[model samples]
Target: MANTWNGSDDPVTRIHRQCRWSTSTLQMTDLESDTTSECTNRWIHIRHLPSQFNIDLLANCSEYPLFDDFCPYLPNHGLGQKTHNRSHSWYRTDSHMLELIFHRRMLEYPCLTSDPDAADAIYLPYYAGIDSIRYLYGPDVNSSFEHGLDLFQFLRHYDSSHIWGKHNGHDHFVVMARPAWDFSQPLSNDPPIWGTSFLELPEFYNLTALTLESRAWPWQEQAIPYPTSFHPPNMALLDSWVSRVRRSRRTTLMLFAGGGGVSASPNIRRSIRLECENSTSTSIGNSGYSKLCDFVDCSNGICEHDPIRFMRPMLQSSFCLQPPGDTPTRRSTFDGIVAGCIPVFFEDQAAKSQYGWHLPEEQYGEFSVFIQKEDVVFKGVRILDVLTSIPRARVRRMRESVLELIPRVMYRKHGSSLGLRNKNDAFDIAIEGTLQRIKSRLAEISVR
Candidate 1:
């Protein structure tokens, strides 16, 4: 039987005092307090961009053409099979979900205020990403440009008192799932390229842009992670998944799941495939539609379509390869993290340069591996050899770190489908980061 102390100053009391010190929740530091305030206290004024720009785009999602770029390395098109698909809503397009999830999360945010006067930051929730994709695949070549032109005209006519009067919209921000390159045209006075000319507008330069990938320009575009499949309903589900990932045995040293047909110029996928095939210890799963090659130790060459298929290998592998696809950023980075798989990247911009708020600052090597693009494609460095060299203890530490990030990286489901509860997820982090940035920008402007 456990011994009971006779007095308040007995051994039991001392043990309780020690346990309190060890297990009690730590008080929020100054940094954490500021972060929480930026997320919940800062009033954000969301602009009413045309329904055609955001709402209508999703309403007509069924008509969206099959985009090979959306899935990237993954070959299968549909979200999950309807018969076996979970209760949650799913989509085939990979990059488009960021806008949808952001919209929902923002609407549900307690700090979202319609009154522009009370706002510290202005949110121009434009559905530019999906609209860009529509025009890219649509019959009309100039449809995207016209869409941007129309949006510009609307904002131009909007009461300047509502936005422009407040430091000329310096606090205004827009979240686009596409990279900045899509909207930003080259300075050669070139014809409209992939995206709209919205960013080119003078007023747009003042507003900040939260995008999947930021450009090299000196403007205010911030890089954010592309949406992944795992949107856990609550923190409990997320914790459970993290525990599972931590408990799972990692047999494969490294895993690369992607398609080969996406890029033609400096076909990194082909090089990766060759290296993975040549290396005996590595596991390679072809994520493309064409079942041309048999996947090493996988059921089929294609597992991109199945969310479970995509996540299983990642969860079971010690390292997940995340090479650039379509753009410098890949959704697989987020997917790998949720599965507690260490991401091995060929490009620095994908996650290292991007996701400064969501990911740890100045510590890319802690949770991820960076192999230079030239080294992988040109120098012929074997991924397996590079990964296997990492000490087992270090690998365990990195995996644990990544498992901690799962909650922060995820988009917690909101509303009746998932119930109403406040949980800090990717959206919270992005909002807080943007608000803090706006505050800093305002300070800089004042100082200048």
Candidate 2:
């Protein structure tokens, strides 16, 4: 809780609390009121804001604007404007500027950058677009990356180290991205921004039956569409969120637990039919096209789905698919867990070191099942019984554990940003702590 101890005459410490963010229930603080004589009846007052505050830009909702350069590590992408792949909704070639996204900051704090030369570089974590506002709301693609930079600039406390070019050793990496199969797509090589995808959490949430709305990063906004009355996913009118919430207010955040793709035999990178012995038919076929080919598939007959779709029926699934993307760390491993599906890995030596991020054995060991490509046939034999025999409670537990991580973790507030809160504008317990941890990690690397 916050240490806002004022004078006496305050309400009893047991007063109930309320938060604006929680969809299921409200929360309260646990503190005794100051009843001292001098402060008696002298209440520690706070102004309640109007119920409907526009959080889209965080202007009226924020107590104060963060400095532009106070925090030197965050980048100033100036509204994420770009000139590439006009078809890409996430990134646009026109009409977007990272600088103009927020109008008031520039005019109000012309001298926002206090010491631009102070910090070495900024690190912007990457996650799949599934978690970014752009994916849900549409485009701002390049702008999305820019906001990451500008947002940190808005804080003015630390600058993001997005040294994406041929830079090395100057900054720490902040991984944030989704699973993409296109090897042609460039993953930033910025310092302090390691790994490829932001889908780093265990894949438990991907397959569960829960309706999670609280786990997305930033918490303030949703990157993916939920099946709700306000933000409905498909045209499934029967599956309205309002009706679902009416039945039960508890809705778990929906996770893409995004999928990944493994390259064929090193010599056959362009092979249409994959020959992995023990892999799931996740979008491949015995004699069909691969998931990678699906995205770039041609609309007309010119682009035919060789085996009809991505996952081939004859393709076998293993415990874990160790397909790290172009930069390595393919999120498919995590996705398999969420979908109650297993992943298969074909060791690409270069990918191993590049994605040596949080491929932890402790937190994820209980769930994932890995196998070497050398023994694809025999090693994959046990997955059948092991996956089926897992208890129901174990599944639920995975859902809870992964969902709980949304707030205290990536979604946790690090500084003075207005976070996703309950109706009472409750503060998150992890914001400052998250910042400290990141700072400490950077310190460990001696990037300061």
Scored by TM-score, the top model is: 1
Q: Which residue pairs show backbone clashes in model 1?
A: 73-259, 75-287
Query: How many residue pairs clash (N, CA or C atoms closer than 3 angstroms) in each of the candidate models, in the order given?
Result: 2, 99
Q: Could you say which candidate leads in lDDT?
A: 1
lDDT of 2 by residue, 1-448 (tens): 2222233422111111111222112112112232233222121111121222112222111122221111111112121212233411111111111112111121221111122232233222221222233322434434332333332232223323322221232222222222222101223533213222222222111111111111223211111111100111122321242233223321111111223233443421222123333334462333222221112222232211121121221122222334333434432332232223333344433122222222223544343334343343334333233433545456445434433322221111111123232211001222122233434544655554
Off by over 4 Å in 1: 1-41, 62-93, 143-147, 159-161, 187-191, 261-267, 281-305, 416-423
Instruction: Note the Cα lDDT for every prediction shown.
Output: 0.64, 0.25
TM-score of each: 0.77, 0.30
What C-alpha lDDT, on a 0 to 100 scale, does residue 194 get in candidate 2? 25
Q: By summed lDDT, which 10 consecutive residues of candidate 2 come out lowest?
A: 222-231
lDDT of 1 by residue, 1-448 (tens): 1222245654224323432442232222222444556545487766766566665454444444455333231111212122144544333335555665576556655565556766789876676777776666665445444546666566666645446556776888878877877777533344546666556666567778888888766458888776666555555666667778899877666777766523456566767777666654223333211121222332232443456667777766888888787678777788789889898888777777777888876777789888887886778776666876777789989998898787787766544234315556777788888888888988899988
